[model samples]
Target chain A: MGARRQPGAGKVLRGLAMRRPLKEAGVLLVIALTATAASWALRPDRLPLRADPAFYRLELDAPLIDPGPALALYDEGQDLFVDTRPAPPGSLPTIPGAVPIRAASFDDDLLDLFDFLAPDDPVILFGDGNLVPVSNIAARLKERGYGNVRILRGGIKAWIKAQGPVTGTASGKEGS
Target chain B: MMRWLGLFCRLAVGGVFVFASWDKLLHPAAFAAAVDHYHLVPYPLLHPMAYALPLLELITGTALILGLCRRGAALIAGCLTVVFMIAIGSALIRGLDITCGCFHTDGGHAVGISLLVRDLVLLVMCWPPLWLADAGPRVPFLCKKD
Candidate 1:
């Protein structure tokens, strides 16, 4: 009965009672380090960070195009219509002849998709009426040197309302 | 009652750590991107952590689940949770729109209040083993196969 040991004191005392606190911690650290090393050596999909390249930044003040003009561009076939939705173009009724550049794979797929087009190609990107995702894709495209990148004002939903042609596996809603 | 609860806590904590490690281990690139989105870590160390963190999670989680070095595992788990909490908290404070990177390497759950509370609950679960007296039979949490 030298002194009363508080309930909370037991927690503090447990550290002293541990057989080898440093050794235990060291072992855990070693395990973590080893695993890290192994992952570095073994894992194939490790992406390293890099500085931004010399590409021009996309203008934040870029205006959104009306569905009428957007649909007209699609009709003319002079502009490239890009559906930035996560779904593949094949899965959804999209602007006819639109290429699916999924926002998920924005960096890689966008680059590949743009490789086939000219630097001056007028690319109209549309999503599920979400400004953030659609703007993000357009901005990235503009950054990569595309001068004419536009977001459809209300995305696919608006395109449908404007009686634009929507043809795919999910068709029959075009102009109806 | 305490013993049963501690066991449940151990399982819950350990199971979570293990499950969280799987996706990060398989897809380090996605994890690195998520980390980069945080903009906290220097660009150089990002990939290194992406690789190391999952392995640490795997080891501690397994150890905690098996009751091997339970105390040590619990401590490490608690520390990791704290680090995660701080990271999430900082991101929230800064209003950074980034993925939590807690479980999925891929962008599954966006960082927000719910994720922060989940981690806090996990930290609390790591507390019991730290304070309670080791009575009856005691098992060493480290370097003991038995």
Candidate 2:
């Protein structure tokens, strides 16, 4: 009976040992939650509890305009073409009259576009073969109440292939 | 010697997390955008997580640094590091060209193999503080007496 009791005692000790870490973890979680709630409450720029689902939809299902239609819009001189590539101000070749607005600096950069562009303007965003940056900017523009934003299909490469009017000197590998 | 090493690991991991949480806390909207780029969190829950995650990091980090609930903090740090590693690894596998948003929400290092390795190293650093008994004297209301 004493020998059998020894194993039970060891089990109890092991359980106690495990309980300490579990208790600590619970305490840590409570502290974190309380801190987070306090911080969120005090911060002036607290994020909205719920995100706009439309933003996600815009990001995932990017509205793309093919080069032919984009070029036609360009010829009509109505839609605003934005170069969304991550490049310096004047380095990258772009569609004539296209505004260079990198998504990384979208908040600061979009200010310049606001001088000439309106919320209702049809804006076409293009990147250097990657659609991710352009898509992000499109979602951002939507958030800012831009109603008609579209991404250029196949990016700048497609625009070049369509013989679209370019402003800067096109390096052979400009969009490749 | 092992105790000193544990202290070092504890401080190192804690300091990094505390530092990393700063910019995200400042520009949480940008951080939300960064997380959205990963496309992991559901859209409805995204903003809340973006708000909460940095706060969690700061709390756990400070706790670890202060040697208060070091084991728990270290465990949370390890868990975060693992999540980070997985996110980076998935990004690399998917060939997504995006900034890490680890330190800065705006323009941090791009997701790559190097970032994954860094997270792995941080994950390793979390081990000692988690397993080793704390060395210093415990404080009232701050640290638990082990």
Candidate 3:
């Protein structure tokens, strides 16, 4: 009896840690299992060919100081400024010489950009307030073999705030 | 022993499928959007497939999980998994970057290489268990007196 075996410290620790009140323990178990199942069910089997979000976003090769640099690029004809942001009541005050490409409904505008712009032509992407459409367009264009793709870091507001002025192309139709 | 395994298989696989189907059926538009995100199927057929798929997933999932008509249900589920794998594999090969949208939408996750890996793993898990059971063979065991 004096020499009777004792449980290991690890076992004791596990027992102490695992020992929850029955009711609470039951709920915890169910939740744990559910999470496990959900993760297992949703995990993908393969990788996407184009997995880089940054790559999908088209940006300028030049320094991004706001939309100002982007505006400058628009002026220099360095890159095409595809503004998916629709007009704000007044005409589109997009950087002069920049094309009007609304961020939304890409399938429509991309064709026009393709018709007018050259492949090696640089593209600066911006959304209304988000890069979703622009990123989406960048990804699609890359898929279509477009070589020069870049997203303006902060979109139009960044440009306007960063000493960037909208020049050229006074015709601001609601390019919805 | 076989009977117990069948029951286990039915509940495990079927319940998942049933719930998966129910969620999608509740919001077909969202599910369709999910399918569109996959880019495996084109626009024209996306709606029609979305309309029909959830129902199919539900019925087969229920049948397999409930242990009723399991043989047929398991076969269908297996086939569906195969079709999905092919579709997803083709999309990956074609350089489509979209979520598989297997369970829920609002999918922001990038389509990963894991997609193919996970599907291949699931196929391995599902195929063997499904092959052993004969049509309704377990039904007799259930009703049999001990």
- For this target, which candidate reaches the highest TM-score against the unseen true structure? 2
TM-score of each: 0.57, 0.61, 0.42
- The ten-residue window of minimal lDDT in model 3 chain A covers A44-53
After TM-score superposition, the amount by which residue B62's alpha carbon in candidate 3 deviates from its true location, in angstroms, is: 0.8
Kindly report which residue stretches of model 2 are placed more than 4 angstroms away from their true locations once superposed: A1-15, A56-176, B135-141
- lDDT tens readout by residue for model 3, A1-176: 68978999999975653332223323333443454344334534211222333422334233222354456676677676666566642365555455655545556766766676777877776654465666666777667677687777556655655556665345543233
Candidate 3 CAPRI assessment class: incorrect
Ranking by lDDT: 2, 1, 3
Candidate with top DockQ is: 2
Q: After superposition, how far is residue B12 of candidate 3 from its true place, in Å?
A: 1.9
DockQ of 3: 0.02
Backbone N/Cα/C clashes per model? 1, 0, 29
Tens digit of per-residue lDDT, candidate 2, span B5-114: 88888888989999999998877767888898887789888988887889889988888788888787888899889999998888888888999999987578999989
User: Model 3, A45: alpha-carbon shift in Å?
Assistant: 33
TM-score of chain B of 1: 0.89
